[model samples]
Target: MSSTTRAARPVPACPIRPGEPCTLCQVDVTGPQDCGLVWLVMGDDELRAGVHRSRLAAPGRR
Candidate 1:
């Protein structure tokens, strides 16, 4: 019998938070929609879903 181990998938961090500071805020913006983090999260379905779920879970969201 042979045993095999599967590698774990990488999970992206959430991009935005209702109250916490964002990565874009720490740097200067060259354009209106120039945030790299936003671009990354928006482009990825998993990351975008994570961000959406977080927003819904935030306090006073209901």
Candidate 2:
């Protein structure tokens, strides 16, 4: 089997916690901040609910 590295998925705009940083980019970001396409729609409850229900339900503990 070829050991091929998979392409990284595009990151959502959701910011890291306060004083928290993005592991991929190492950028210091936080909530209520805009990153990109996904984050842009984060304000919409319906969209958020439909798309991020699972993620919202299962958050990793720091």
Per-model lDDT: 0.63, 0.48
Please tell me which predicted candidate would have the highest TM-score against the true structure: 1
For model 2, residues 1-62, the per-residue Cα lDDT tens digits are 78989999654433423233444443444323435544655567876665555555445722
Residue pairs with backbone overlap in model 2: none
Worst 10 residues of 1 by lDDT: 10-19
lDDT of 1 at 11: 38
TM-score of each: 0.54, 0.28
**Local lDDT at 60 for model 1:** 75
TM-score for candidate 2? 0.28
Error of 2 at 61 (Å): 8.7
Residues 1-62 of candidate 1 have per-residue lDDT tens digits of: 99999998543332566445443453675422666767877799998898789888988763
